[model samples]
Target: MKQKKSSQSIRWIIEVFLFIVAIVIFFGGLNHFWMRPVNSDLSKGNSQSRLTQKKFNYVAIGDSLTEGVGDRTAQGGFVPLLAHNIDDSYDVQVKSQNFGVSGNTSTQIYKRVTTDNKIQEAIKKADLITITVGGNDVMKVIRTQLANLSEKSFQAPAKAYQKQITDLFDYIRQYNPNVKVYVVGIYNPFYLNFPDIKQMQDVIDNWNNATKATVDKQKKMYFVPINDLLYQGLDGNEGVTEKTETSHTITNNALFEEDHFHPNNIGYQVMSDAITKAYKEHVNEK
Candidate 1:
């Protein structure tokens, strides 16, 4: 009886060991066959290096707008669309790299151009450079003040705005003297007003005018007035309505992200179209 009991105990141990071994193999196979590839694809989708190849002809530099804040598709931001459009329109093999970071202002970009090795290299190789900045600088300050007071109380700092704009232009010229610079004007975000929002629109107009002046002063630079493109009636007779928000205006949502400032997918496409059109015009003029 004792010998039989010992033999049964040994068999039970073997069975338990086999069960654990089978579980390990099952999970290992699942990961290798299924989960691994999904993870790899996601990583590739978010990879920044994939945006531009070495020595691209066109380069986009600025804040979240340039980074494709509004685009939901992972295929890439407007930079890719701009590149493809340029190729089709100009019949030139144009490649583009986007060096945009969320919440970055002109000051940040100025520092980046000098200190960031990757950006420096991209600027050196690029024949065309597009920028969308100064919006964040103005918006951030306005939002902070508006949080506690009425919209009428909001006033933009003229001196600070001038300095930032000047510094950004100076930095770009100092970095690459020959590269064509296209400065994008700020889009109107207060079309659908909460309260005291019209003042925000006025501030945006001033900021855009400053940007235009700088571009006008430079020989190789041009200002792409996206504000005019997105907002209907450049005569300032009407503001963007909620009905036209999806196609023409930016909204306060995740599509626009938490900031309620950046463009969603639709917004990014509009920007891409404007830049592509400008590039085509420039090529034609040449």
Candidate 2:
């Protein structure tokens, strides 16, 4: 009876050991076949490096301006121009991706950056990023209050626009904290067309000011003021102010395309010049 009891005890110990070994193998196989591949794909999707080995990566985002809506060049708008210049001046190859959706509001742009996996990946890899938002946000308010325009009318939209701007930067930083961001200030496209509406000028200025303040607080971000570059002095506001004077003639109806809303090729050239100048100056300082 004693021998039989000892034999049974030894068999029970072997069964317990086998159970533990089976558990370990099951988890190991699950990780190797399922979990590891999922993790690897996520890393590749978010990788900042572009194919074919470029020296610099640029990501441009914003509204119609970003889309180069008025640009006659089939080659995209100011982004391509800026990319070319950067390549020549810096003597480095640049891979550029423009994620501009025509007529996009700040809120829409926020959604795109957060949800669009392709855009998120491009932004993550960007060495330099340029954003031109808030224009459509301003336009939305202007359209609503066209007849009943007032300084007070702008206050509400400005507040809302600020919130969207805050959210935009937040999303960008979440993806890539170290990339340089240049927030292109909104130009008064309506200044020449609707000069009599003095409140419009005030609205544009307020929007630019809000953007400047927001960008000032963050490192590796800058506010590129194109207001002065595009300002042609409408409705007796001011003829021209030489903030950062450019040689290009920005005024004249020819600068605007047929729509009278977007800039023509020459006008886009002026914008490209302003952005490139700002970039060069800022980079030199560093």
Candidate 3:
């Protein structure tokens, strides 16, 4: 009877152990797939403004490029680089706050601006705002219509992007009425690599044109073009290929990082330059 009882207790322990394992797996999967926290990590830098008492606050907002994803240096991508370039060139005390979250679409950024307290606070105090979005919005359409390509593939997404982008600009203006808003245009990551997928370039350009139109109607908002700088001359329909760095040359897509989705360090630097130049031009106009 004692031996029988011992066996039953062992079975109960095994069952309890399995139950705990199941619970762990359940919650783990839940968090992994669904429960991602929606907050941008706020990082503040550059104290030269403190010493000089100038106090120029620059806030960068948007997706992974704004978060500095492909920058191997991990220096928070083009946001910080733009800040440093502006301060160094202009000789002004600038404080840069990066509120960029990777994989965030235009709608997500609009939500962050309206909902996230930290991001809202930064925007409130920002002297300038640089936004890089609409890339993921375009990507969503591409992914859903991978096997099928058409002229109408991006029409819906582009319209959705226009609304979200308009709301984003409105939110920024609501928070910081006087600050300069620079909207970065999306580049075609697949342009040089997937020449056959000619629809992507048109999709990107259409989205960018929509974005430019939105920004043009708003006061203190400027659209910065980075698409032309990233992979120029690919024209989508051109059945052309260029030699890549690798001996196994595939296509002329030399601007993208190893992921072939995001920009490389060079690409990000070019982005920084473009934004900085725009900012300088804006400053001169002011």
Best-fitting candidate, measured by TM-score? 3
**Poorly placed runs, candidate 2 (over 4 Å):** 1-54, 233-254, 284-286
The candidate, 1 or 3, that scores higher on TM-score is: 3
Model 1 agreement with the true structure over 38-120: per-residue lDDT tens digits: 00111122236545533337777877677665566643456677676665554455666677775677778778777888777
1-286 per-residue lDDT for model 2 (tens digits): 9899556545433443443354345434432211110000111222344243346888888876777766776455787888878877775667777777776788998998889898898888888899989877776664565445456777888888878888889889999998888899987655343333445567678879988998898877889887765565332333432234533222344244344456667667777888888788777543
Q: Considering lDDT, which of the candidate structures 1 and 2 is the better prediction for this target?
A: 2
Candidate 3 matches the true fold with a TM-score of 0.76
Top lDDT hit: 3
Q: Which residue runs does candidate 1 get wrong by more than 4 Å?
A: 1-56, 143-156, 193-196, 232-260, 284-286
TM-scores for all candidates: the values are 0.66, 0.72, 0.76
Inter-residue clash pairs, candidate 3: 68-77
Ranking by lDDT: 3, 2, 1
Candidate 3 ranges with C-alpha deviation above 4 Å = 1-50, 233-256
Q: Model 2's lDDT to the true fold?
A: 0.68
Candidate 3 local lDDT, residue 118? 81
* Shift of residue 94 alpha carbon in model 2, Å: 0.8
- In the range 40-140, model 3's lDDT, one tens digit per residue, is 32223455544664557888888878877667776667776787786677665677777777777888888888988988888898888889898777656
At residue 242, candidate 3 shows an lDDT of: 54
